[model samples]
Target: MTGSPLLALPGAVVGEGLDAGVAAHYGNPMVEQRRLEQGRAFVDLSHRGVLTVTGPDRLTWLNSMASQALDRLAPGEGAEALFLDASGHVEHAVHFVDDGGRTWLVVERDEAAPLAAWLDRMRFMLRVEVADVTAEVAVVGVMADPSALPAPHAADAIVWHDPWSAASPRGYQYARDPQHPASAWNWTELVVPRAWLSELADAVRSGRAEVAGVLALEALRIAAWRPRFATEVDDKTLPHELDWLRSAVDLHKGCYRGQETVAKVMNLGRPPRRLVMLHLDGSDTVLPVAGDPVVGEKVRPEPAPGEATERRVVGRITSAAMHHELGPIALAVVKRAVPATIELIVESHGIDVAAAQVEIVPADAGAAVEVPRLPRLGVRP
Candidate 1:
């Protein structure tokens, strides 16, 4: 399939569309990063997929299927939803925005075909139309002042403004720090016609605009402790584990796929595992990959068989990046019971790297950690 024309630029390091898609860096990642942080750069995320759902039943119908309440969504509003299997395992993470007439869905490129097929199969008798419009439209991510971008393609271009508003009304944050990176997170994506890439590319070529690669974006995302479907999810993954409940799942929303498991896990107990940010030591010069084992100093009273070593692999790195502000950082999935005080190690390929645990999902990650008291039968405050 053809992709964003900008990917052909010199020094553009292209990789799989999911992880590093367009460019790793346009020669200097640092300069590109500044431009992005200052709202002067954008990323060509057209490599991702775009699917649209039309017809009158779009909102109500979608509400019945995803983990978010979409029925009340007004025009130009956006929300993140998860499609899960019967057992509540997240199958797809959808970032969508609606313009009254059509609801646009953004997801990993590889996920488009399958997800579209499933949606089609589910639309038995509903007045819904699902179409993959990826080829006709492109997605460009920008961190610069979004207002500066041209208006959306009259009924064609749709800008999905991220509501990284520290916290949303329908969400709850497990990380209570006021200075969390997400509190300042800034990014937005613009959907344009496929042919618009050349003009945008020319702007970067003529020094009118700056182009930052996915690597820079990934670094910012990691620093912000944001989770992505491509890097952080697995078959057994639950939203709570990644503190995603703060942004994705609506606690009191109506039913949808995986609602039961989500409610049960959040209310009655903690997720079996949790997501944590790792401040990796760069001394070893080895960066952990998605599957790199994260071992912790064994504090088990009795080491399990084959676990006699002082440290045992307890988790794996989900995403890693070298940030502009923070040196080397990574997000890892680890057992919920793991102590936050433990020394985590990522030893792989003859590199022994030490990591400091910065809890994204606190060890006590549960929804009902505090119970509210019922007011006296007839008494008032």
Candidate 2:
């Protein structure tokens, strides 16, 4: 895809890779981040993919395939859902809202095509009509209530207020913290006609509204401990691993593609891994990138006569950013056995950056039910 029209604005610097064709920053990132968090600025996320599912069976068809309870979702109400593979690995993270006639889905650019194809194939006898409208529609982001924004919309102007801040009904929170960082997270996305991209740029240029870029938006997301599909998911990721069950999974909902594994893990097992917020030692000028190895010392049986221990890779950094308020921070998915209090090392650019772990998903997450243990071997009488 070509760069968004917003890239023509002054100070716009194009991003790379997944963020390609979008502005990564606009001259000053920290200033933009502050204004954005204050709800005084908006971001151009026109680079994201948009999909629309219309028809009478749209809600029910989607409910049967996603993690959330979507069948009864009210018009204008925003929700998050996950599309999982049979084994319960997250395949797509979706943010959607219905505007009476059509359900608008906002997803990462890379997942858009594949997700649409998969949904299309599942349309057997359903009344739903799926269409990838990425080239026809655009998304705008803001950290404010939708009522006040004059974002351009098509026939159905839908605003998706993120539900990550609070636990969804029929959902479970794996993070033990009584006050999760997301409690203060207020994010919303506006679905508008692609042609209005110029109007939005005009608003920014005229100072009717301020503008921020991907870097600014990302910094706030990291500080809020929000898990994004493109950044946090891997081939082995279970929603439980990132505490995503609090918002994206309905524990008692009807069966879906990966419900069996979701049920088993919640009822009788633990997630093999857990998510944590890492406070990186900012003394080193370099920030770790995604996939950087997170190493920590662990005790193991010695090959010789004595016991030995060595630093081993326990996990990898899923995302990292420099927050306007928090210094250098990151989110990492590590083994369930990694101690919550351990200080780990993020190996990046041939340098080891020290990081202190703050637990997001506790080590004991899952196994929601209390089952009685039977006698071990023949020891019990």
Candidate 3:
């Protein structure tokens, strides 16, 4: 993991493990989170990966392989796409934007190499060229508005504004909440030269702009019901389970790798699992981390003896955070059979913490289209 120049600032605490080499916070996390919420701060995501694809065949080639319709994506417009395996499981969640000549793909830190290799293999006879430029550029994240950054830096930066709030014409939304939290999630990522990181650090130090840590950014993302590939996805995860079809999967687009399963789930079957926001019990002062088991009681039928009910694992927490206002919250993916009305217990550090379910993906999250039944031969109209 390459270190960011901002880590040299006073009170900057570097993150550990997977978030190594990045500042987790700068002395005061609460204040930083508030600044971020108000669009007054920027997050140093230089640790994330950046890839660039350039060629005349770039748009058409990517559109044929990606779940999103990218063939007609105009320059400066940003979109999300999913690269799924043959079995319809999500392999990658890509955020990309084109600047006419070049297309930039901003992905999770660990995905850069693998994605580049895969794209290179798929190039075949196409003119597209894939290069992992993670070391050449840094990814800076801004919320609400991106124009708050300093003048010269913002002028030459390539920005990828998130399109999660809007409905895709070729996609379908499974989460039917009238007031979805994502409507306020105006997130954007800017690609800037790595050497310019010091300028951003100076801005933070001089009060020209504020800076927030990854923790603050993640808390707000979970609150917004945003699905990040790194945290929310696993081997068996499907896009419908996270309501990702709303932004990443194009239902009406031409066939891709997992189009059969995507179509079947959307038109005839429901996803096996569903995503839910967990409002955790903060009394224990313990927030369950990612991969924590979510358990619930279930009735066992035809028990051998006196066993009438037992506790069973129903789901697992994908991401958890301590929000500045919302207290402790998490996003979990649970079995579709898990009743939304039931209170779940999160097993965190051998302690059971109560979690109330806030429905994100409904139990019946697929089979969206209504199919008409044919009349029998002898039946009247």
Candidate 4:
């Protein structure tokens, strides 16, 4: 991994491994979060990756390949797309923006190379040109600034403005919030040159620019109930379960790789699982992290003397955070059969915390197919 540019800023703490992976914070997440919510700071997203596609057939070709209808994507327009296997399992979550001359894709850091390679293989006779541009560009997150950085690539820093602030175009929202946290979500990622990082951080220190860290961004993102490809997706993940129809998957788009499964599940079957926001009980002072087992109160066999019944694992936490206002919160994936009123427990290192489920997708979603009535003895011959 290359050194991140935000390290030039004072008090920068780079979180290595799965949890932090990038600049966790410049000391205090609360202060940084305040700065971000107030549009006074930016987050360093250089650890992520970027890919660009250019060609006359880019839009139409992409339209036929992904989950969204991209053929009509106008310049400066942005939309989310998902790459799925033929079985409909989510393979990749894509953030895309078209700037007329080029279509930029923002993906998880480790996925850029593989995604570009896949695109190349699918370009047999199309005019599409695919390139992994991670080495040439960096991603910077901001609450409001859209100014391009002073670098060749940054000259037209393609900004993929987040559409989570409101209900997406023709998308379905399962959760209703009168004052949604995303309502103030002005998150935007700026694609800049790798060399411009230090200058941007310096601008933050000299009071010329404002900056935050990934921790603050994560906290706010989790609070908004947004799903991220890095932490939220697994090999068995399905878009409908996450309520991703709010942005990623369009129900009326032309056929794509996994359209069969997507359409089938949307019209005839219910996803095996559903997404929920967990309002965790913080009395234990223990917060669960991603992959923590979400155990429910299911029937268990009798225990021996001085023993406790074994509770079956019903779900797993995908993301968790301590929000400035919402306190400790998390997002979890649970079985579709799990009842809405059930309370879950997160067992972490022998500590247990109570979790209340807030529905993102109703467990019974898409299970409305009618069954035929059997003929009775008194029926007409």
Candidate 5:
């Protein structure tokens, strides 16, 4: 399990083994403490994907394909964009940076090659070059003051900067990582050079900054109501229903594949369902896993003692985690008309749990007004 050179970290122990799919899960107290109190941390996002687009027509080619308006991006600027299918469903989400002549698309590892292939296939007459650079580039997460790090692409070439702070300094920039696209206003990302990995890791470990584990990281993400690829999205899920239209879809952008469906949904104003956050009551004993059914009507049997009843089929849990500050929390997808205050049962791992009450925060509650939009493709009654 610890055989991989990349897995060797001081005081770090690999659990579930490398063959288990997860590289490692940090249970270190120091790491957990850093995540809770500092409000900042660094994690190994090496599993992410990076692709480079070069040539004179890079910006025009990407703008025409993605939902965001990439044509206007200047060098050193980045944008959150999405690629959609005929139904306006997200095929991939990405963070794109325009470095004068070259554009880089950062995505999730699983979607990297496929997205590259899609981009290549779409390169009909455009004079652009697209290549997967995941091997040459490494993606890492940094949460703190942008001033602390030198300007990206400086002498060292720091090409990516996506800060999460609501009021990040003028020099700092934040962009969406299409791999883990979320509508939340609190999430931010940065693309650093692989050469700086040692220094960054040491800085985090030495207490100058915080180091976050997967569990604590997931907790923070849930509290922020951010959506991830595996937990919140899939082929069958429409981007609008997931509230992806706000950040990933550009209504005013030029023609692109699947623009019709995006326009239809925006004009119609109704998606099949909406995503919501749930507060669980009996989550203390048994926690609900992803894909667990969320009842809407009638009580479902409790998997344990002292659990609530009277549940109806409302939605399903997409992500769940226990936070040091917020206790147990979850994200669910429910029918748009479902009452936000309804109690429900979420069954996971053969355990039926009581979800105290659901809370539906407006999709754009605190989001930026200037955020992009996707045109309504159609009305779904």
Candidate 6:
């Protein structure tokens, strides 16, 4: 594992056995316990992006580049945005927040520099300055009452706040604000002095919160059906396919890199595959792993009471986790035409396992309602 100064903090423990591509940590037990109890926890999110947007045209430039309307992001408020390819596939996910006069962009760590470069190239005549602040800013995750803290303080040290009633997934940093507790909300980034992180950790440790590990976080995310960056989203995924239309894409926003494709998909019909939640058959001795084939209809008609042969290949599993509450919950991207409830099999470790009673929903059905599009930077197209 590469050495990161951020991970070297006292009482911080790195995730064991993970490869180089993944970076995760378990803060001191005390901090984790307090976070769990108060539903407020903080972790080192340095592995993610930290971008600084300065200069007069910062807001205008950002509003044009991302799928969200950035021009209207008032100080202490933040919005979720996406950097899409020409075809509207998400290249990177971003959290845009206003910090006093400057704007900060929190993105996936690996994408920070590339996105910065892309923005710089598009600066043609804009007066905005883009710089990668991944190394400078220490990103931490906080889940708590947003009303307790102001926006400026949130944005400075706490780079991201989701502010959703339900806890956000592992990679996502969200807070449950009193104002918009049920809805998906964003928060201002708060900057914590590096020297003070230890003190904060101590304070949290002394409390009742338990440090949550990646596995625990995964369980929380799976239950919510929140798609992750690399795991649930990738090159082949369209924003709409992953159920990201509600949060990542601003349909009413002006033209962006992939607006044409997004609009076409929306105006035309559903994508080939849609994201859905899976309820695995408990009797199956072996559990299905991700990437296992989702039997489609061609093999046979739907299972007819204890018939194992009535299965066909349809799609594949994207993510699966054994839930403490739900007992073996999974997320899969299956063919659009498949029945809402069907019996499928996932092959894990050379074992064929049955998946029963999958609850399928159209990727775009509930998300097509008209909402406020992020305000554009300049004039409308």
TM-score of each model, paired residue for residue: 0.91, 0.94, 0.94, 0.91, 0.77, 0.74
Clash totals for all candidate models? 2, 0, 0, 1, 31, 30
Clashes of 4: 1
Task: Rank candidates by TM-score, best first.
Answer: 3, 2, 1, 4, 5, 6
Deviation (Å) of 83 in candidate 2: 1.0
**Model 4 off-target regions past 4 Å?**
18-21, 145-156, 176-181, 299-310, 368-381
For candidate 6, write residues 335-376 as lDDT tens digits. 777776656667676766667634434532432335557877
Query: How big is the positional error of residue 22 in model 5, measured in Å on the Cα after superposition?
Result: 7.0
- Full-model lDDT for every candidate: 0.82, 0.87, 0.89, 0.82, 0.62, 0.60
Question: After superposing candidate 2, which stretches have Cα over 4 Å from the reference?
Answer: 147-156, 299-309, 376-381
Poorly placed runs, candidate 6 (over 4 Å)? 1-13, 16-40, 146-159, 163-197, 204-210, 281-290, 297-312, 356-381
The TM-score, computed over Cα atoms with residue i paired to residue i, of candidate 2 is 0.94
* Cα-based lDDT at residue 210, candidate 3: 82
- Clashing residue pairs in candidate 1 (N, C-alpha, C atoms within 3 angstroms): 39-144, 153-157
Number of the predicted model whose lDDT against the real structure is largest: 3
Q: Write one digit per residue (lDDT tens) for candidate 4, span 1-381.
A: 567767857888887655345688889998888888777777888878799999999999888889988888999889889999998989988889999999999998888889998999999899989998888888887777564233343356778888777777666665554665667777888877776777886676777776777878888888877889888889999888887878788877757999898878876788889888999999887878889999987644765687765587889999888888888889999999988888899987689999998887776676435656689998897
Span of ten consecutive residues with least summed lDDT in model 2: 147-156
Candidate closer to the true structure by TM-score (higher is better), 1 or 6: 1
Which digits, one per residue and each the tens of the lDDT, describe model 1 over residues 1-381?
565678778788775536455667777776777778778778878788899999999999988988877888899888888888888888998988998899999998889999999999999899999999988888888874454344343245687766654676776677766788886677788778888888778776877666888888888888889898888999999888888777777877857888898888877778889889999998777788888999987557877887656767789999998877788899999998888888899876768899999988888666665668799898988
Clashing pairs in 2: none
Candidate 2 lDDT, 1-381, residue by residue in tens: 455888989999988777887898899999989988888878888889999999999999999999998888898887899999999999999997988898989999998999999999999998999999999888888888653344433234568889988887789888888878898889989888777778777777877667888989888998888999989999999999988998999887968999999988888999999999999999988899999999997755555567566889999999998898898999999999988877899999999899999889886565989999888896958
